[model samples]
Target: MASKSAKKVNLLDHNSIKHILDESVTEVVKNQGYVEDVRLSNAKLLIGTSIIVVALIAQFYKKKFPENRDFLLACIALYVLFNGLLQLISYTKEKNAILFTYPPAGSFTSTGLVVSSKLPRFSDLYTLTIASADPKSISANEPVHFTKSITGWFTNDGVLVEGLFWKDVEGLIVQYTKEPKKSK
Candidate 1:
């Protein structure tokens, strides 16, 4: 019952939610001079998870199919290896981006904005965390997060958000971060 008291933003609308990501990136760039500094707990997790998966797969194959263990192991190893290399390449490409911790977003890890660069097709997912300084609107102390994927080849593109909502995002960011507002 208490859950109904606090409203939450839908995390599935790709178009509407894209506003948060675009505005946040704009806020950091237009106002902060393209500052790119924030902690991202997700990248490390990606590499770490890859290692753990390879180990787990090896264990599974060793127990269930010992007859063809080496061949299976080699195949799994190649797959994980390919994924790791992709992650590394994506990182070097997105060094200009910044990350922030938005709790309600997926794992609260892979959410961020790319400053001054085109959105890369593989990595650096954007998260929508709408925070407020005013106590009246949806969120004041805690931020409201919305998320949609534009990270892969299938649906990735420039984040397009409505102008009115974008203005709201700009105001919220400036209100909290003390950055100057970016004019529309």
Candidate 2:
């Protein structure tokens, strides 16, 4: 049998091992990112509807409130300007996609990857893309978790961007950071 001092040292080692395992599990959960297929489709639909609604509102005000044309025009202009500004801010703040050259076969957390760029476009509806740090080389059906900040911007846009991040995660690139800047 081991001596008392040796036993004590073994106990300490056991405790350290437990601590490390616990930390790894916690980190895995924190790094996981998931977005469902339906959610992504819904986001695209919602953004499309928003654009249509804005256009209709502008048209209605222009015709119905002709006497107050200047006011309505100002309102519409402000709406468009503000909307574009908000979208721009969101694009800058949110994560984009991880274009994979190959897919992954197992699950992975978004701790190792880096965020390269966030692309936002305004043609018909708002769209965003996030590039990843590593080249695409993953296996099929790989599980991926995308870690992203979800507190700022409009929920619709945020959710859309979040879903995009998740899709990229599925492709085996997890772009997440523990320190995300908070917009004031």
Candidate 3:
């Protein structure tokens, strides 16, 4: 009888992994960006419409009550100035695509703290502390802290913490440090 050896599964190639990460990030950014654009457009339209309506009303009142003309003019000027400022601020809002790259498959030490970037709060790119099982292993069982310097993908699905073969490693831990900055 011949003895059979178990086949080892190699990790994915770096390019393949990068391609997958790129596709996923692109999809998420595009969807979110589109929603933001729609909201801004609607706000601009509403403010413009309100200004027009107010001007027309002021014109009518000015003719009938000439004494109130000065007050009406001041109100209209304020409205127009506010509207212009709002438009300027909206135009300056950031809408550029955020480029994300996933780190290559390798072992890293766990700092025991995980943090997320400010770009996407709900589901965003995160930095994690990956613990090593053996002192002689890739990371030498030290705490690994990945900053924004190390690129990674955004995933709502959490990573696996426990494995059957690793002995020195108690387990893996992942946590988000803070919420992302909210948009207006």
Candidate 4:
């Protein structure tokens, strides 16, 4: 048969496959940043709103209790101090630290791979955990075709990644291994 003479060829070349995987991984990292920002933003909004409400209440009732004005003033001062401290720490130290810790050994899946060394904590002092399930069909450390569908989350000191495929992750590692090509 004429069809028998045709041999099966890979639909994607190595470079194209790599490019696709890299883009997928980049998307995941971007998503992670967006999620982290939302969390931080929500926290800041809550703190700012609480401080404003309490300060307003204290000012409104200050005239009713002339003798206790000092106490209310002290409370407002403490609230402001707390807000300042949080901003100082968050901007100075925790600014860039709020990123997803990439796996160093090149994780194909969650199994037999280390995700993070130092766990990050929330403002509420809760620890975070990142979890990703390994594919049953793939062997440990084995590479697979990259397709981005990993759903990860931050839950009380944890991150959950579902169906972690490595093709999407290779981009993160490739930078470390190869130098960028410079244009002449």
Candidate 1: segments with Cα more than 4 A from true spot: 1-31, 38-42, 45-49, 52-64, 67-98, 101-166, 178-184
| Candidate 3 TM-score, true structure as reference | 0.29
Span of 10 residues, lowest total lDDT, candidate 2:
1-10
Candidate 3 per-residue C-alpha lDDT over 1-184 given as tens digits, one digit per residue, 9 for 90 to 100: 1113321221233433334433333333333221112444566677777877777777766355668877787867967886886668455532222232222124233222111123233333333333222325432334443333112222223221112211111122221212234599
TM-scores, in order shown?
0.29, 0.28, 0.29, 0.34
What is the Cα root-mean-square deviation between model 3 and the actual structure?
Answer: 18.0
Give residue 174's lDDT in candidate 1 (0 to 100).
48
- Cα lDDT tens digits for candidate 1, 1-184: 0112222234455544444455445554344333333334355656667777766666666545758677677867776785777677567644433343232233222232333223334444554453332335333344444334443212334323334334544555545443344599
- lDDT by residue (17-90, candidate 2, tens digit) is 33322232323323453221233335545665776676667776645665877767776776676578557644
Q: If both were scored by lDDT, which would come out higher, candidate 1 or candidate 4?
A: 1
What TM-score does structure 2 among the candidates reach? 0.28
The residue-level lDDT of candidate 2 at 139 comes to: 15
lDDT per residue, candidate 4, 1-184, as tens digits?
0112222222223333333333334344444332222444566678878888777778776366778778798877878886996788577534433343333345443342212112222121212112222325343333222223222211222322212433234343343224345599
What residue pairs are clashing in model 4? Answer: 127-157, 128-157, 128-158, 129-157, 129-158, 129-159, 130-159, 131-159, 131-161
Q: Pairing residues by index, what is the TM-score of model 4?
A: 0.34
Number of clashes in every candidate structure?
0, 11, 3, 9
Is candidate 1 or 4 superior in TM-score? 4
Best-to-worst ranking by TM-score: 4, 3, 1, 2
